[model samples]
Target chain A: MTHPFGPATRLALVVLAAASLAACASTKPAGPVAPRGPAEPEAPYRPPSQPGPVTQEQAPGVTPGSVQDFVINAGELVYFDLDSYTLRADAKPVLDAQANWLRRWSAVRVRIEGNCDERGTREYNFALGARRSNAVKEYLVSRGIPASRIDTISYGKERPLDPGSNEEAWARNRNARTAITEGAR
Target chain B: MFRTKNLFSVLLAALATLLAAAPIAARADIVVNVDQGVTQPLPIAIPAFGGSSVGGQVSQVVTADLQRSGLFRPLDPNTFVQKRIDVNLQPQFDQWKQISAQALVTGQVTNDGDGRLRVDFRLWDVYAGEQLLGLQFTTTPENWRRLAHKIADAVYEKLTGEKGYFDTRVVFVAESGTKAKRIRRLAIMDQDGANPSYLTDGSYMVFTPRFSSNSQEITFMALRPTGASIYLLNIETGRQEALGHYPGMVFAPRFSPDGRKVAFSVEKAGNSDIYVMDLGSHATSRVTTDPAIDTSPSFSPDGSQMVFNSDRSGSPQIYVMNADGSGAHRISGGGGRYTAPVWSPDGKLIAFTKQEGGQFHIGVMNADGSGERILTSSYLDEGPTWAPNSRVIMFFRDSAGGGPRLWTVDVTGRVTAQAPYPLSASDPAWSPLLN
Candidate 1:
């Protein structure tokens, strides 16, 4: 937004006659397209102002089927093997149930949070977490759910379900979880 | 939230120790050996300065700086044969030699007529009884630490023939709170774990902060509930700008060698790809097109090629490609998962994080993916960032009982030291040597 109009376009003028200065010829040139920043989104750079620790317990506050109920009945959590974003066959039934539940509460929007174990690098885990969340969201969308209804966020290894460092804990941590962020239908 | 200004302030106390070192120089004419295996830290003595009380504190800073480099062992002050050696005194070679001190560093700090701190230091070879290096600096009292760092650099260079990294800064993420409610803020500190100050408030989760080659600007990933965005923060001005707004999650952001472009990863439709964006035009071009995850991009020193981590090989491994996304080839072989490949400053080697067994390691390999050597292994030792000299790497190590803390490792794997910080820290990005 700080860039001004007519920026990036430099025009040169040549006066061949004494009176030519009074009669100016102008031309509009093709200019590069400028990408609009998120200034319209009210402080786009800052996250939501609620600064605190993040955890799964934050999911129980939603209306229709308590967020915890959605986790229990619809199987809102999906687990992935090490270094693999591909869901196992066991994850399909959970996605099917999640899709059915989301269809019933069409007015409620959900967010899929992906996570990783603390094994790999943080940034790489971030991308892996992103892939995992989108994998879950893609499954939901493929099952007749609207893509717009599901938002995906990846916490990498920042938020772990269990504090243990063993295999059981890592397996449980490398998961994708779904929560209802918007009000329920 | 973990925003307590002193949520961990055990750091400043650690700075009280002197970090001086033994010289690599074996003889009067011998410079510090260039070989990593030839490390014989020179024994040096630095008595309290004669002039001001601050001079004594400054001597501690210099000693701490040198000792932290792992190249020198500062002798105990009680071991000084001479009780009070004056900076202006003639050569006390016999007194320093009596304590087996190979080098004697003496300095004096005086308040000039205008109140400036006029600091002078002399590095002497005890055996040769000749002054090895002598320098004086005049600065305001506020810059006393900088004066110490300058003296350390001079001593280190005189002995090792390599410029020291003490005069540099490290930008990292300082973490607080429990695992479920973690607060991560961008923090910067001296390379010797001094002068740590948070750059950003822990309002949002900040990740993957990397210094630009210019060292003035830092690009990192910030996550909010709405979405994740890549942002550029000016270190001096504290001005921040959204580098890019992608349709999906963008992470693992890095600046090009020239600071003119950035390479980052964006995940869309279950696929993650690396994209390079020119800073001037804000135009981005995708570097990887496969369905597999392709992220953690690092450009070669010459900027003609880029080495990045991709899962195109079934497991995440290192890959190399041209700057324009052509001729992509896999460079990593063997077992385990290889990710987080960072090209060295000299353009000849790449330092990376490898997870083969249950353990994670920091390793280095040639640009062609050959001569791979594992430097350090631990429960989790990832994110390898090379020093400007390519001789050292700083990474975060996390174990069962301990949280992640910054640590440095020599490429030879012989010298390992913790970048001591009182609080939990991670994702250390070393800046280019400052002016």
Candidate 2:
């Protein structure tokens, strides 16, 4: 069969496509620019030597035994399957790292925050989230962290990490996060 | 339910005498049988009241109230052959019969010249040509809407042999913002979605606000990043107090039928169970000891039995047990996940949210789990609350990628409509009819 469109319509389509391409091209930055320092420094700045790989304790800006350090060196979140409190296989490593971090910072008191996706009802999800946070707390306690140093709260589906209504967002939302509620530097 | 039925029969017997003079063949009374699976709406005509602007507005409100019930079809004024009506005088039955109106409502509003408005209305059975009800209400001029609702209630009760849900209020959680950071506040409004006011300032998230039997108090759960708390709030006085501290998260609070106690769920160390607390004594009792999730406890109208949600059978399902937590047995059967089971005020049916086939549904079933009926199905429809009359159920429906809005469905599933509120809302709790 012949082309479905006449010459004028085909010409208009080509023009529209070209206009969309121009719009897309405009979104990209033209080039990279050098960073600018502050106009004035409180004290004369000294250029330090290029630093080698440093431990989290010696890292710049991140204080040792702090909330930021725990978040950076050890993952704070572990995800669960939908409508489940069973920790995923991949989540085991994260919780293991968290357990080790908590053991090192023995004085840090943490709260395990449990959450769920939007698929469940409000009251039921609250119970489900409690189960999830408890799952994390139990795992940590099993790995040598004292139970007394930890607290748990279930946000249910009230607090969501991802707002999208798709499976990926729901996966991210069903999680338990270890929050440093006290004893952080 | 038995008390209301007795009252209805008594009213019917009294009205029978008024029809005694008519021929026996024409003595059939007008009644709407609401128990059937399908019902044809009774056609009624409500003309503008005779006196002032408030008169017309009152008539409009009364008309709207009856229309929204899905039990009455208010005829258009253009179809009214009788142009004028007087509250004290009889209507022309021939004109009403010609337009197929089974019931006629006539009323007049008078300003007493002392800042009070006097309104009187009469409900007539057009077929029998007899007055079924005549009542007058006197109130401040600004309270015309409530007066109109009272009149609507009178008409509904006279025709259907059941109490009316008009003149009541609904307490719900008004939600705004994105799902990730939603702001939910306790909100209340007239049953028709008028005179809405926020009871809480949307600072922390609130959920599942349930009205007490008296309609003056509500118990709701407020969730914060730190923890969760259940609060009992007196709506009339704006006085609120936390339901005391528990060892764990406390949520899903609901008042007993008599409004003397509150039942809620407390979660500790990943396990959740139901508990009840007496408001007067402040004594708390554990209702369920199941290791699995046991939440959302709703009491039967007589306060003898409790229906709640549980997952002990490996999936979320509804269960019924004694008020003291004995003889708990699963009441929900089938393949769906049933949650949020609320016992109807009439104590005949249980409403719930069922999730099956990747779709959520609002449904009701007999208290024994027999005669299951799904009223609505959508991407998400949850948290079903029964109207005071138990004929209608209000719930929230959340669209994919959108916020939730309140919706109502009658028991027969024959009529469904979105609530008039224009914001994201959920967890609707309908109050009992105002005294």
Candidate 3:
């Protein structure tokens, strides 16, 4: 059998093989460097200790340095409209930036904390939180990051970042934040 | 012949001794005239269950339990003329009666050397002026809330002539994050929704948390980012192990009455079925083979039968089956959509969420599906959990335009409002009687 292969094809194949080999080499590096302390000590980057891909992107309306501070200090808060569980367009650029940073580091994982405003009962809030977290997972998956790298938990309004009783607080309370763990490859 | 005659005499002597002791055992069966006809909340006084090295905080929890039941009108501790809580110290009945208190609860607490707290309490009938029951147990100081609930159970059983529910704990999913990328955490709390602590952070989706029959472990559906599976979590140690690694989603889990088995719903493709697994062996068996959505399985107190919500009969309805998944029968008669069936602790009634005519209501019926009586109604009411006494239910009702709120009702359908939280809350699961 005769095969038609151009130089570009050969070059692309070379790049693909190199990428896979790089991935394989990076897989085992998590053990020794798994303890890289996050930038912020109080809310240190305790990434998922498991192996997976990472990516980070700056979200729209979120200043580049601002998201880093959000992840480090007071975690990022995602807001939602009434009766809706999908991420807003404004949230994409922020999540994409996080996904980009997540992609660069291997062996590090993120904790997707789901929360809802005090609008529903405890159990319903529980279900609602699940829906929100699942949305984040699905988005990260769409961004080419492996699901194993991300873990989710819903606070269900039990832990509020803001304890005020106004629309701004409610809007701020309805969100999910990502915590980058320490072990980065 | 002489030896046989001697053996017969010895047997006769033992029988005579047993006959002499029979009346003594009978005398210990304390009797009190309790009127079942009255459905009013019973008025009782629970003195600060004393014995705290620092401040007696657990006593306040006990006070809260009695106050929430709507059955007992807790006397104000501030107005008490005299308060004595030492277990060895006798309560002044005349002083308690002056406040119109019908029942009194008192306890002593001591921190054990091994980081455990010891609590001993007694429920006294002030009207009868006698100790009705005495209870003692040891737990960590952190478990003082549980101790208060245990005290409430003792007082409830003594006065209401029914089981007390304060000893129970609730397991449910906890949430945080945004609607898009939210995190769902597993959490457990006291029956009153206090002392809520997270078991798992939202690294995954957890649903339908049900306590084990022994109240030590919990079974719920956890969807890992990689795959969907159910998980069994221990409440005390926070250890979680995944359940059946199947090709699809497994959810709506409940423990068998004996706490030895777990029953849950597994969905493959578009079809859902009920399956039971032996917790010890991790062996699973299909309970329902139909293509319909058969979920929400609850076991009878004897562990012989199970009641679950199924859609095989067209709309969602209640169904019962044997432990081995044989002899399936429908217990919910013609009605609206019914989900979340919880068998009564007494093995007499099944409480469930009934949706009739667009609105949701909490209803209870006999095991046979007869005599269905709705206990609660609201624009959006779901997740009906029964108290240990089988006389009351605690559920979340979403008020119109406002957030979801928690409410309780008697078996006869009288509603008593509970203190609402600032945020939305739902899924009220009453814990087992504590002590």
Candidate 4:
């Protein structure tokens, strides 16, 4: 196949390679060459680094409208009290950021997964998880996200984030997570 | 999947022989009083059945069944002074009495010459020197296990004067994977933990599989990341379908006594309410309008009332209301939080799981919520299901830092044992007596 890069772009790559070599050489010690043992293996090859700032849309891995972007930029998890579906005060800011993120990506559809600790019975925890997820969904709706764009599910005590049986693990397991389902890059 | 044939001719012959051979009363005097809080297990002898190897297997199954019930202590075959007793002939009452065996079970398995097996069993009152029960069952060779359970049921009923729960099945959630990303599939097995198979793949999560009165259909909840839905599955046909479309999360599905309606919960905007759907008409009716959480609805045997779990009383407690959702009132009157109330098949009691002081217990109360009794206690024990006879309750127990396992307890709290299967299991629902 023919080369895809033009002469000008190739020149730009050569300049970037020279700058990287110069930087590496400056880090070496300025002393006489010592007697070397056997020949050492060459260092692993790395691509030349671009100097300009990359926009969110042009990020290397996570694109702007991707699920990773939604998960990393805005928080996806909110914790609840034991046997209580009422969102904690600290959960408000995280959910607010989620709502703002959803607004910016209006086409994205999300599913709220409610989970519980192993302290409660199966059916009751199922109901409690449903309540927690709906609590998150309603808050999102109140923050201008459309209700139609969101769905909810309750994993009950079946899916515990922390398998430990202690109070700290239980506190961590009893939470709701937002998952971007559709219309993401 | 085998057909059972009742050998009436053989039964009549056995009955005639027993009636003519003994002068004592045929009824067994040594009865098991299951209602008493404490009673000694009756010592019975069950030697290997005569005939082929299948006979030995059947006898073993019967022995296990009676032994697991905690009502009978089967004497070791080595302890039997009179071995090799023929089913067609009477046992020596003197030799049996020497070993202190109150009752004896003798059986024979023979090929019926057409690739089928015939089983003949006789239950003897050793002290009275008379046969209490005799019957014959014929089925395919592969169906010997079921025939063995049938024999055990007959013996149990003849001795205790109550229906037997041996000829049944249990549907449960087979749990695998870690606690955070557990994969739950619907599974079932014989009451004695035989013929186990998974009905659903472990692609999504499933919970609370419940059997209908017919024993062939089940209703359970399947949860996915997007939403939750209730499904009806036919165990025989391997046919499954979603119940219907709802605007909210639907779960906790259970069938009515007649198997014509399903009662479940629907949650919208963080509030859950109970609803009943008629399977024939496809019409749904809202049963509870309370603003509080109302779920886990179990119907009475007569189908006139429902027992459900609710938080309307400020905490999770058992509640009973009319079938049409009238005259609602709280039934549980204890300190701990009570939930997952299931009415017994006989309509006499309501079983529930109680959480208190960092411990969970399986308990039962009268229909009016009086005469409360705790049967089993552990780190976590929940979801008690009633055997068809309503004499036994099966529930799941989760130990500290361990997965859940199935366990059973008699109503009197006299017997508690782990299920035969060793896998992690939960949410067991016992089926009605198989037809």
Candidate 5:
């Protein structure tokens, strides 16, 4: 291969160059053609910058994103006394913790969905569950979390924590749960 | 001679008095409360739809149509009287009377040799010894079964004094998955839970599906990749469109009886309230005004009044108001939390989920919220929807182990049975008669 290209390289290159120029001249407009440009070097790829966790004070809306996350991580189910929609005294520690979390993560969005056991009328139990969940939300709001970050819904007896029929199941069912969605910062 | 004269006199006097009382009783109709009754279903006798050689599958359909009502007990064919063919023309009062049946349905089907089927049926007040109603239907050969259902409907409407729900469909949430994240699909089945097919996959959580009276469209809540939105999915075309998707959550979607509007909850800035949107105009009217949480709105069959779940009572209770949001009254009394108030088809009762202590149950009461009765017990039983007949209620029952299953019960609290399902199912919505 080296012998074949070396000897005839100059003569073949001249003939090939003439043929290529003729082909280009045939395809192009008659008068003039711009000189062929030199190729430019390619640039290397760079990674994108990572986003930082939303800060409590920096997040939009009234409630902080960190506080809402803390409340969510701690747990969403808040309990009440038997047959009562009022938030029980025992539930305050959890509510206080949630308040602190909301304080830290003010931009986070949450839904306080009220739920109930398989004991009452489905329609009325919905209202009761709403009452319970709203009660929890009001407590959090009073403790300095903006009401806007805490949306309330009543699953009533639709969704339950425990699907059992026993007293423990009932106790677990008579409560509210929280869910987080993209609306949170 | 004296003793013979006395016997003849007694016999003649008894016959005369019985004949005289017959006309008065026949004029005075018996009032049967079709909606309210004992667990004992009404016993009706249909003697195989006797005819001369062309009954052709009509009797079986007629019998099934009445029996599936869960209100009528059709007598066994084997117990039918000899020569029931003659009974169709004119039921021998004594023969039906002997079986202790209250109502007798007899029909004759004949092919006129002109590519037409003629069905004539007579409903007899067996006790009264007279025909209550009779009609004749002529249709194509393929429409014999429909004709039979029509005849049965007439008989049912006459005897029960209420419209029949035999030609209806059921839409329910076919559920599968764990306790934390339940996957639910929308499924449609015949009123008897037959011919079940999925309308949508359980890709996301779906809730509170309701059928338009035409049975062609369904309104429900679904959480899509974008967010939770209320969607009206056309049952026939498999097309879906989002309805009123605001920045916040919108749920608890229910259609008005007329199917002209839908009432749902729209949450903005954490406050939830009931809003009704006219399907034609896309204009929304707020139906509730409290700072408290309100959702789950249901319209009465007449579309004049609405019942919804509200926490305005400090505890959750059911409240009823005029469709315009006037005359608001708390229908649910003290003792439990209530939710999901579905108006009965006949506009007599409201079925709802009740929670007391720690347990939840499906309960019902008069539309005024009196005579509240609980119909189910479980770790979680909710969402009681009336069967089209309004005689039975279907609801969801869940155990701690797995997904919620569907069950149905009579108003009397007896005859509770699990609704047949290939998968765990819940959130049943009954459809009105199709066509």
Candidate 6:
């Protein structure tokens, strides 16, 4: 594509942005996340990350930027069916994609949070949530991620991505989400 | 139940004749048939205790306590046939009988001018022309409601053969905010929903505050950013200590009947197992080593056994085991899914939550696992707690499209009422009757 702005114009805009960077957060505010619904498994999903004949060299500490990029672009969540922890066909690909991304940037430590819909008993849902998180961890380990790199917590039905009580919303709520906890120095 | 009462009848009959011939020692027995399926609530009359504002408040509290039990109906004050201007005057039995009140309650209140309250009340059988119970309590003004509960308990025990549960308290997780960023705080209140107070700030997410059977303490699961773990809190002293030092997540905790041990589930490598921690020694022992999820461990009343929910059979089912964790047996046969199995205090029944066809129910089965009867059904009804008497179950009912709120159902399966809470609440733990 041809240059949209002239050099002089770009320089002027850059100077203005640098001047306002410190106060940008005060000028702009973030809004609530939009509603999400029952999600179908992603297509062209990669299987769990696996090691080759020769072990791959481990990556270093995760960079915050790359971790954020993985969460935003590579997908950090996998959904589950009602009261179930066994991953679905669609879920495999999404998890496969997650495993591939984690393998490529192996230094990052993550905490897997398993959550459930607001239906089962809180205590029991907690166990179910753990199973979901552990299921994801097992898949990632099968793909070559070090088991030590991943920790897990079950939020049970206590936390939900979608507050709606409908099945569509519950589907969104029943998910395992990964948060980048430690990045390389 | 009636046979136990019959044991006292023979002695009472002899005493009744002696008392009748000797003009009595200042009391009379008031008999009211109180048993399961006693459909008609006994009609009772209560007049103001000498026209004081405190008396009016006490009477109102007492009336609500009785009515909430689904056993006694307090006559409307506006329809009272007699004036209550004199606290010392005797109640005219015929006047109460005229209003068809089977029982009469009259009381007096004294402020004592030192911020202490003195409450006296008497239960009279109007039709029988006899007084059943008389009791007096002196307490601080701030504990006026407790006095009312004590009076109600006295009246309830005299009429019903069972000990009263009115003088009780409940601990629960009071919730607020939305589904995404929900806030939960530990809360406590009188069993009748009065004197509600917050025990914890909403900073940490807390679930399942279960009362220790032997004291003013509770064991609950607290979720923090670091990890999910179990905590033992002295509700009275505000002392909190971590109950487990496990590196993995620990949740779904309950106190042993003696309160010396706490049974909880610990999740490691995605597998949840049951563990018992002896509070005195702080030593933990694994109860279940299975790979399946085993949680919601409730101690049997006698501490000899425990009932918990497990999915070893590929589905969550109620299982019973010795307190030391041997001899696992499935007790929930008539099920779709069963979870949260709590042993009733009387040891005769085990209460649990069952889910089938997308609906949840609070149900009970005999101790041996036969005769499963579903109690209340709704979009979600889980975590059934037994009243100290085991005659009632309190649980949280989530409306199909709304948040959770506290609800209660008696064993009769007929009386279900919302236990009022200012905010959304769940996982209620009813305390044992206060001494």
Residues B46-128 of candidate 4: C-alpha lDDT, one tens digit per residue: 99999988988999999999999999989989988866789879899999898889999999999989877888888999888
In model 5, the runs with Cα more than 4 Å from the true position are A1-185, B1-31, B39-41, B50-61, B68-71, B83-88, B108-119, B127-129, B136-149, B224-226, B357-359, B371-381, B387-392, B399-405, B409-423
Worst 10 residues of 5 chain B by lDDT: B1-10
> Which regions of candidate 4 are displaced past 4 Å?
A1-26, A32-65, B1-26
Local distance difference test values of all predictions, in order:
0.80, 0.86, 0.65, 0.86, 0.71, 0.80
For model 6 chain B, the run of ten residues with the poorest summed lDDT: B12-21
lDDT of 6 by residue, B1-435 (tens): 001111111121111011121122254444444446358888888887753468888988888988878878889877777758354455777778778888888888887677667776677777667656656677666667777877787788778777778778898999888767779988888898876878778888999999987547888889976688789987666778988576677998999888899999999888899999899999998999889999999888899999999999988999999988899999889749999999999999999999998899999999989989898999999899988888889999988658889998888776788985756999899999865
Give the winner by TM-score: 3 or 6: 6
Query: Each candidate: RMSD to true structure?
Result: 21.5, 11.7, 18.0, 7.9, 19.6, 14.7
Q: Which wins on DockQ, candidate 5 or candidate 6?
A: 6
Q: Which candidate leads the pack in TM-score? A: 4
**What TM-score fits each model?**
0.83, 0.85, 0.61, 0.88, 0.67, 0.84
- CA shift at B361, candidate 1, in angstroms? 0.9
Q: Among the candidates, what TM-score does chain A have in each?
A: 0.64, 0.68, 0.58, 0.71, 0.59, 0.64
Q: Is the docking of candidate 1 incorrect, acceptable, medium or high quality?
A: acceptable
* Candidate with better TM-score, 3 vs 4: 4
| iRMSD values, candidates in order | 4.4, 8.1, 10.6, 5.5, 10.1, 5.4
lDDT of 2 by residue, B309-386 (tens): 999999999999999999999999989899999999889999999999989999999999999999999999999999
Better of 1 and 4 by TM-score: 4
Q: lDDT per residue, candidate 3, B1-435, as tens digits?
A: 001112111211111111121112212123322323235556667666566652267777777777776666677888787664667666888888898877777777887688677777666667667666666766656556666666676666656567677766665544455433446666666667675666776666665677776666777766554445778876655567888687544666778877888888765533567889998999899988886667778889899999987667756778999977789999888668777888998899999888777578888899999999887777767777777677777777765445555677767675456633333445555556433
- Runs with alpha carbons beyond 4 Å of true place in candidate 6: A1-65, B1-35, B85-88, B112-115
| Total backbone collisions for each predicted model | 17, 0, 76, 0, 45, 5
The TM-score, computed over Cα atoms with residue i paired to residue i, of candidate 4 is 0.88
Between prediction 2 and prediction 3, which has the larger DockQ?
2
